[model samples]
Target: MKFDQKSSDKLFSKAKELIPGGIFGHYKYAVRNEGPKFFSKAKDAYFWDVDGNKFIDLICGWGPMILGYNNPVIDKAAQEQYSLGNTVSVASPVMIELAETLVDTVEIAEWALFGKNGGDSTQLAVMISRQETGKDKVLKIDGGYHGANGWMQREGSPGTIDSDSSEVISIPWNNIEEFDSAISTFENEIACFISSPFHHPTSEDNVLPKKGYWEHIQKVCNEKNIIIIVDDVRTGFRIDLAGSNKAFNFSPDLVCLGKAIANGYPISALVGKNYLKEAANKVYFSGTQFFNSAPMAAAIATINELKNIDATSLMNHHGNDLKNKMISMAKSFDVDLRVTGVPSMPYFRIENDDKELHFKWVDNCLAKGIYMTSYHNHFLSAVHRESEIDLIVSLASKAFEEIIEV
Candidate 1:
């Protein structure tokens, strides 16, 4: 059964008075769904809305919930933390323990600071970089998503970045010369280089760094005393307990960690080396809600679970399997499907001029109890099972057949 739009619309109408557009941001408005069908509950890999229409949840809370929604162990740990009087005037032992766990597990994380969102952590990283390097300009990839903060979203375009904040420079990804020129051109004025290794443009191509690209970049940053900040908001625990940093075999001065850090709970961290952490000390970086205990407690449990299961490898395997299956099936349907991404994450696209057909396929999948936003950037969860894989592939096969007919 489908969710009743009338009731959902009622809730949206009521919500709009207090919350803008009846939700958090513009993306919520972009959702073509008639109304927000609130989730009633979720299990390992499936969830139902208030109207009780179940979905496979391919987006997986936008790349968190790696261990799955309402995970038993995580819930039990959260409950235990609550039973003990969640927060106190003093710090919880779990906080330091979690920090220690991060530093110990992540090779580059000599020091760490926790926060409530990736935006916070990333902005903090920026603050630390500026302090450490005494530079105001930050170089970022043109389309990279660091967060939604002013500095993060401020672009070279009009109404984005103004002359006062003219230090911000946006460049294309994977172009070594462009980066080198920016560094040499800006020199001491450039403080940091923040970027994501994987490019998730609308094309769904999971391009990797060219051979030795990272190593060469690292050398350049070292030469110029420019701090490197890697935004692993989407890749953090999903890529590894450490992040894409470890996967690429190159470490950054400061790392923005988020998303899967707390198994879908709102927790993020800025892990940096000595100088960077000291730089943060000089800057004013504090949030009242950042001290909230629930997400921290959840993070502790999530880290422990990650250690116990070597979950990154598990997620990688499942993602690879699902991607390969879909690729094979799309080929059988005579569709040029380019499936790409690391094992932990995967994306797909139809190589054709008919971009509208992409949305049609997405809608068809949704009609069949599959929840995918678009084929451009989809992900896998650790909770996804072989049975679910078979079902998704089977449904995708059917969708492709129908999509290619016209």
Candidate 2:
């Protein structure tokens, strides 16, 4: 099942001459030597590499291809908008339409602002919180990623100064005591408490929020006057249409959304409650391409399509089925397989903390055209229905068989 990488290798060689890292995106951190370097095309729940090898795309372009690749509905919307106007000198009405759609969908979203990436929305949300609270510090769960902003990154990441994270406090996830301690230490200095709805850090078993975790945090933040910002960028439309906070049964003042918002279009959103609307209006954040209208059109269509199909429940059905099938197949082979996070976005791991064995298993799966990763969680989409799951799990079983034979 080894894919021919001659085409991929040639591209990498050329890319290295022009690109500093040759492969700088998140994929570089996850791909294997045998993995696909460049994709020729992608369809529903699958993509083809340059060598004409096709693989079931469980990663879904790192959580953007929620409906499918080159989907007619989304593509038609973007194309229609492109013909009308793309990056004009002014904003488009489609932006308002998309915002209205989000306001109608997300529970806490009364108003919405647009951006180009998850980082843009997150950075803007933090600024708005700071502006509203007149505070200088931010509190977040340790290991919770909010894109590539310097303050959102760890303290000593490359090209970031120690002062980059000077006012940022990192506390443990699912630990109310840690949150309380940070709040106590920071007191009135903290502006916002931001984190994903759950703990889905790469390379670790995804941990759900313990009982009453969000409730306690919400209560404390309410009492302390700290703004609650839920970074729902990755888990946006997958968990619940009204927002991931609805699934967790908590309320956030600001919600950051991206990734699958436009079904693979380059757009992000920061939606918030009425109280933060004035602060958001006062804050200044803009990008050269932020006013692009095509992605906004795509986002409107994507949201409508998700609602029409009840995509969240569809994906959950398929993801839960895949989880069950894989676990059952692994049992037959005496392999330990653990799947975590939401049913629609599952992280797979081999038990006993065996990193080497887990990587080997993932490699085997990738070679056989069932795209999987050992570190990050994989996304399921509305199109990944029963047929796709059958193929994915069947190939995964073969991967297990090969590993056992070896």
Q: How many clashes show up per model?
A: 0, 0
TM-score of each: 0.93, 0.98
Q: Evaluated with TM-score, which candidate comes out highest? A: 2
**Per-residue lDDT over 234-272 for candidate 2, one digit per residue giving the tens place of the 0 to 100 score:** 999999999999988999999999999999999999999
Model 1 residue runs over 4 Å out of place are 1-6, 26-30, 34-36, 154-165, 202-204
RMSD, every candidate, angstroms: 2.4, 1.0
Candidate 2 to truth, TM: 0.98
Judge candidate 1 at residue 152 and give its lDDT: 70
Root-mean-square deviation of Cα positions for candidate 2 versus the true structure, in angstroms? 1.0
Please report the candidate that would top lDDT against the real structure. Answer: 2
